[model samples]
Target: MNRRLSFSLILAAALSACARQPQLDDPVARGQRDFQGLGCIKCHQIGGEGHAWGPDLTLVGFRKQPAWLDLWLKNPHAWNAKTIMPNFNLRDDTRADLVAYLSAQKGQAWTVYPWRTAQAKALPSVERGKLIFNMAGCVACHGQDGFGGYPNNNVVGGLIPSLTNVSDGYGRADLHAKIQYGQISSPADPSKPKPLIYMPKWGDQLKPDEIDAVGDYLFSLKPKPAPGSAAASDDF
Candidate 1:
């Protein structure tokens, strides 16, 4: 009788242990658990579900590569010191799982997403560009009106370049080419890891006219110099 009781107890404990263990085989499932349990929803919104305190992550998969996402999740401050995002000190496996989950969020759930807005197409070129800049997540890195000061890992000056002075260096054609082809920032230290942030190619995502409109919006951001100043004369 005692042997049977011992066996029953062992069986019960085994079952309890199995119940407590999460499904470790599926990273995406584990990631979803982490997303909720870790309070990521408090700051970021996905598919208009969470709070809007941070940049909307509905299309993060489309904008960011998996490697970049993994690194960012592991240590946000390492990439951007001034970022409001707190580092959770996540384990390697946990960070990978979260990256998998976030990477799956490519904005397909929304029937009327920002990039497909018909109203934007009808607006003036400059106005449409402004809308696209914000909606396409340019504001996240470049800052509002392209007055950029965002930090990037191993990047020169440790911050993304501001677009306010782009016209000084790049003509309309050059600007268009940069936007369409995208740019990979060279690391400040060639020995160190590359910068986490890069310009994603918009050519595949945005129409030709939309790209032109974005150029117009960016050109408009150039600051007007005071009259008779050398900068003013240079602009002429």
Candidate 2:
């Protein structure tokens, strides 16, 4: 009877240990989660999973100083007026975690900027356009794959509008104007009054052809005739 009781107790303890939730005590894990939760992946890639809109951050730590990254992440506009990156308004703890995570990213090669090199072809390819869409920081505002509301406008206080199928919403000319010349007012409904947030112009950052390529990619994000046939969208 004693042996049976001891065996039963051991079994119960083993089961309890197996059922317990995994601890999230590790800072690196927390940082990675914060990186994703804060919508960093919308613009930057780690391990090639995220969009290419921003610099490939796999090895950013190796290139930039930690102090600089912290300051830049805090407020990019302070450094550059033409920067496309948005202020995340991160909590101290959250910012620390994100910094910890980003600082740890290393060992990956940087991706080449397509426009920096001479173009050998007359027309841009969709594949190249897709790459430019991310590298150009369009994903910073528009979600990965231009889905929009990445961190969710509600989560971010309605500062951003959705881009799920922006081509359908805005005409080519209107979209072109908004992309080339930043707009403070709502492109969807100009009569609705301007919001505090707005889209920045890419005139300074992007070459005309680069803008055209990114524009093509955005237009291609239009919903397919068969929803089931479309690729799964990234909620990150």
Candidate 3:
């Protein structure tokens, strides 16, 4: 019944939804129908209804790593046999299209997601936003000041970089997009083919406004003076 994977996935990846446009491949429909034929609908639900033996697939693409999805599809049993879901040894050709189909969906339209350009301006009040950070168990990981925290927690974990430094890394839009979706990978782990770790999708867990506030809070973490500067100007 142990469903853990044997040869570690050793997977790693980047982030993108292709701002140009998403192409609709005929293979996706094939994957969808096959998904139904395989009786995946019996235990798992996508946009349609199905028994709830598994977590809702409403936003799975944003939750899991793509490589993980590919591996999970090939052998869920290898990772967790106790899983009620059966393992389907699918062909690589077929699995590719199947993944494309499933990964290309947004749970529901008009959810006031973080990616919308118009809504980006409604950032939260920094005061209330600070406490939300603490309440959401964020301080536990990103640290009390959103600087950084333990990532692996297993063997020696990875170093989580400080949020205070992200503004220098990407744009406001890029930051929001990354936050809503998730990070891909970094220079530290380049050889692997899929994303290393994933951040849970908060598109649902957070209200649109809360998303804005957290966005504001994150966008605002500036560096403090080096230990001893009592008379610094707010603008300087």
Candidate 4:
């Protein structure tokens, strides 16, 4: 009887240990569990869930490169000192797992994202363009209304160019082409790594009409000079 009781106790202890171990068979699954367990939901939203305090991550996979995302997760402050996101001091493996999970969020899980909703579609072209700009994650790098002060490593000026004066340089057709094909920002110093924040091509992703609407919205932001002013005369 004494031997039997000792054996039973040992078995129970083994089972308890097994229960304590996290099932990490799948990295994406583990990452998802960590995403929820680590309170990321408190600040970031995914697929219409969680708080809106941070940028919606539904289309992050499409908008950002995996390497950039990994670096950002490791230390957000290193990239943006003013960013409100806190450092979790996550381990390398944990960060990789999280990246895997986040990279899987390509906006297909939901039937329709907020930007493609009926209400959004009903808005005027310029208004709808504004909505697409924000919801499609252009605002992540360009800032609101293309104010554009975001940093890009190895890029000229050390910041993304603002679109407030795009009209000065680009015609409607030219702007549309730029948006469709996108462009790689060359490094200021050839010796350094390429800029991680180059624009992504939207031709395959956005419709032709949507592209035109974005151009309209951008042109509308052109700084209007005072009537009959010197700046106004330069428009000719």
Q: Please report, in order, the local distance difference test score of every candidate based on alpha carbons.
A: 0.84, 0.64, 0.58, 0.86
Give me the runs in candidate 3 sitting further than 4 Å from their true place.
1-25, 80-82, 109-195, 200-206, 209-236
- What digit string (tens of lDDT, one per residue) describes model 3 on residues 9-87? 3221112333322344577667767777778778766654676565546455655556766877888776444456676
- Judged by lDDT against the true structure, how good is candidate 3? 0.58
TM-score of each: 0.76, 0.44, 0.43, 0.83
> Using TM-score as the measure, which candidate wins?
4
- The backbone clash count of each candidate, in order, is 0, 4, 9, 0
**Order of the predicted models by lDDT, top scorer first:** 4, 1, 2, 3
Error of 1 at 11 (Å): 28
Pairwise lDDT winner, candidates 1 and 4:
4
Candidate 4 clashing pairs?
none
* Candidate 1 ranges with C-alpha deviation above 4 Å: 1-25, 226-236
Give the C-alpha miss distance for residue 190 in model 3, angstroms: 7.6
Worst 10 residues of 4 by lDDT: 107-116
Tens digits of per-residue lDDT, candidate 2, 1-236, equal: 69999999999999999677334576666888888777888987776678867766765554344665676778777754567899987777777777777777653333544444556234465556677665444565565777665321112344355665778778867776778887554334555533433455666556676666667767887877755444665455
